[model samples]
Target: MGAKERYILLLIIDSLIVTFSVFIGYYILAPFFLQYTMPVLITTSIILLISHHVFAYVFNLYHRAWEYASVRELMSIAQAVTASIITTYILNILLFQTTFTRLMIITWMMHLILIGGSRLSWRVARHHLIGKQSSDQEKLRTLIVGAGKGGSILIKQMLDTPAMNMLPVVAVDDDSTKQRMELAGGVRVEGKREDIEKLIKKYDIRKVVIAIPSLSKTELNEIYELSNHESVEVMIMPNIDDVMSGKVEVNALKKVEVEDLLGREPVKLDTAGIEEQVRDRTILVTGAGGSIGSEIVRQITKFQPREIVLLGHGENSIYTILEEMTGRNNNIEYIPIIADVQDRQRMFEVFETYKPNIVYHAAAHKHVPLMEYNPKEAVKNNIIGTKNTAEAACEYKTEKFVLISTDKAVNPPNVMGASKRVAEMVVQGLNQNCKETTLVAVRFGNVLGSRGSVIPKFRKQIEAGGPITVTDERMTRYFMTIPEASRLVIQAGAIAEGGEVFVLDMGEPVKIVNLARNMIKLSGYKEDEIGIKFSGVRPGEKLFEELLSEDEIHPNQVYTKIYRGKTVSYPIIEIEKTIKQLENNNNIKELLLDFVNRKEYTKN
Candidate 1:
């Protein structure tokens, strides 16, 4: 009903109940108090009616959603009724010089019951009639995996929101005490986690939602595996806090992704230390539009930097990141420079103008096979571009300079890896002489959901209804989320002294073929439905990528998931000479690889 109609209807009902309550109370006590006549009763009715509505409006009793009424709503009605009764008692003593004590007590009881019943009946009627009709519709039989507070809330929401078309049939909890216990909407916890497969068969369940927000990755993976039936789809509930706070709806369950099954806990950052180093500092990030660069920008903003210089070759990307940063925070100044890092003059001018306290040089050509095909382009961007930016940082006396290196740079076989290694050497070489700027490198493996990453490629192939290609069955690479990688980069800066290559502990290496299979399953397809194709490994691709070389391993973690490698000392002159050769050398790829791998370039 419309708000006006609901208000008027409730008002009429309350007025009638208020008038009848006083009259009935007077008549019931009339035998004892024979002196009180119809005139006195009529006077009491008028007083009760006005006082009830005034208190009702004060308590906002008329504006509540009675269809969703609970104890809280009933309590509001009680308070309003009691206040009105007290007002009527006081007015009776003043005007009639006599008060009906028994009548007032009886009237209060009747008024409370009638008002509360009128509101609570809406909830009872809606729950039975509307909920039953919704359940009768064609809905997926859902199985909830947790029977705690999160599970209870989810079940109630599912029952209340029939338009979602997910009928929660049963729930499962590992806790023995909760087994066979009924939760909201009469959905009982049928069995333990081990009984998931059996329950699916027993209930013919089509959907399973893991409702435990604090479930560990290992436990979540186990639950997902058990619920991985051909016709069944597994999903996860959003965080319980988010749901309760109205940030997201309970019905907004997300599909399980391979990233969730990685079984690695996120690394906790030293927030206090990071903030001390980053807060109010003028920070500069090259390649600020790319995946890792953009995430670093986002993470840095948390510390409330005074100003951020976003330098990138792509105008569109720079504009995009600039727009996003400005929308979120207006206090910090964001300067976007659409200039390539390879432009020495432009890089120098930017540094001189901003004189940033810290620099994150993320600009680079990172694709492996693509870099191999056009080694010159990789040399220009990755090698020379890094040199130009690092040199500018040194000249500008920047406090700290962080190089976003890659795992491929260790024991490298690809042009991209070799180029990044050369870029690292440039910073290491410069850090030797540049006392003002602390230059360090943070190395990590492939980040999930980055541009041109395997996950997005597999998703597109699955959407196209065909085979998802795996480069090789044996290919394995370390994986971390973009935010994790970026956060570690910032953390590395907090601990950086100089010339140290900080390797991130990218937990375990995952096989490429297995990752592809997981993606297909997560997309609600069987193995046969989306066939796997084993294309031979591409050029510059390795069977496995290493985070640190044997000689470079520090054997101790400097921080959580962050290790500082043994600094490799490279002669600044030779490093510059090799970069100069990239201008006209025909065998640029061969020369770049030779320079990075040669032991002679390192000092005794």
Candidate 2:
């Protein structure tokens, strides 16, 4: 309605309510009190009508849209009702001396009911009238896998938001107490999880929205495996803390991506340990623009570092990391230095200038096939970059130099892996000679959505409306989310002493075919229709990638989940000669073969 029309409607309604209340008060009390008459009561009624209108303005009564009225609206109603009651009491006490108890009680009840109900009535009406109509036509029949606070709030929000177009038909929860119980919005909690298939068919549910955001990876994977059943697309609500903290917006309610389905149980780390390492310290993240480097950059900032240097080779990467760091944390000092790590002079300059107490060397060429094709570049970047960074750390008297190595470095068949093996050797070899700096390496598997990862390639293909290609059906690789991998790297750094080849226990390897299949399904395509083309495995692509070799394993007493691998050690003379040959000559192929065949650059 227009402003004029709304104001006129409000005035008319307030006038009628005020008049009716006074009239009723006078009628019942006239016989019992100082001979009250219609004219006196009529005068009082007119005054109250004006007074109540003023009260309504004070409460922002006309300002509020009743569709959103709740406890807050009711609170305002109480305040306004109190104001009207005081005004009425004064009028009857001073002029008529007719304070009829029963009459006043009736007025009080009527005033609250009539005034408060008016504001809330429209909202109740909207749900019943508008909601019923919309649900019949526009609702997406959905099932809730978790019948908890997160689920209930999501359901309420859906019901309140008419545009959501989602109607939760059933709630599936494992909590026995919630079973067969009706929630606030009359949503009934069904029995335990075994009833998923039954509930899906019973409700004819088209979609499933999981409300357990804080669930451990194990719990999430279990749920995903169950929901992998046909025809029921799944989604996840933001976790409890996410909703409360406002990190996950209401619109962030979304379908389950591959990560959510493949995730493992949550790992509760010693935050105290992490904070102890990061707080009040200057941290240098090498390759800060890359996936893992950026994540460590993110995670470390949360602990409020003294300063963080975003050291990377690529100019664009430096800018991107600087941009991200600036957006997330402005309080901490972040310097983006773009310099190739292969240059000893450049690395030395960075170390002498920044003087960072802790250095995280994440700079490396990680792509397997790409590195295989460009072995020379890989050696120069990965092996040489790592050596320069480590030596500079030692020279600068840095406390810890953590190298971000990969599982590929262990018994590696590819050039990328072989170079990383040499890189690990450089770090550990430095640790042996240098006592001031503790050089360590954290080895883990592929990170999903990293640069040149299969996930991004599949997404791009899907967006272009074409056949999504997979290297091989039987090919399998362990995976972790980008941020998760980075966090683990930081955690590994915090936990490292010296020459500790810490390997994160990546839960299980996922088959490449299955990953492709899930991505296809998520894009709303059937297998046969939007065909998945099995492109033959590229050069250096293995059928199955192993985290470690059979012989290079040992139990660590400190952290059971992390194991230390046995690495072949080279004589200082041999190491120096190999590095000199690599730097002097561009023939990385000869060095890689000799290093791999002799296992001279093997795991530690």
Give the candidate number with the greatest TM-score.
1
Candidate 2 per-residue lDDT over residues 1-604, each given as its tens digit = 6767767776787678878886776666666655556686676777677778888889887777777687888888778767876786787678777664565567777878887777677788877987667756857788887878788778877788767777878888999988998765777888677787777778888777888877776677677666665666778887678787888765467777887666555455667888887888899989889888888888888788899999888899889879877886458988989888889899999999988889988888888888878987888898888888899999989989999888887777788888887887777777888898888888899888888888888888888776888878788999988777777777777778788777888878899888888887776666776678888988777788777677667755345346666644555556667877876776776677577557434454
Model 1 score (lDDT): 0.90
What TM-score, to 2 decimals, does candidate 1 have? 0.95
Which residue pairs show collisions in model 1? none
TM-scores of all candidate predictions against the true structure: 0.95, 0.91
Positional deviation of residue 283's Cα in model 1 after best superposition, in angstroms: 0.7
> Tens digit of lDDT per residue, candidate 1, span 233-316?
999999999988999988889998998887377788999999998899999999999999999999999998999999888999
**Candidate 2 overall lDDT versus native:** 0.79
Residue 404 of model 2 has an lDDT of: 87
After TM-score superposition, the amount by which residue 83's alpha carbon in candidate 1 deviates from its true location, in angstroms, is: 2.2
CA shift of 317, model 2, Å: 2.2
List where candidate 1 sits over 4 angstroms from the true fold: 33-35
Model 2, residue 502: displacement in angstroms? 1.2
Q: How many backbone clashes does candidate 2 have?
A: 7
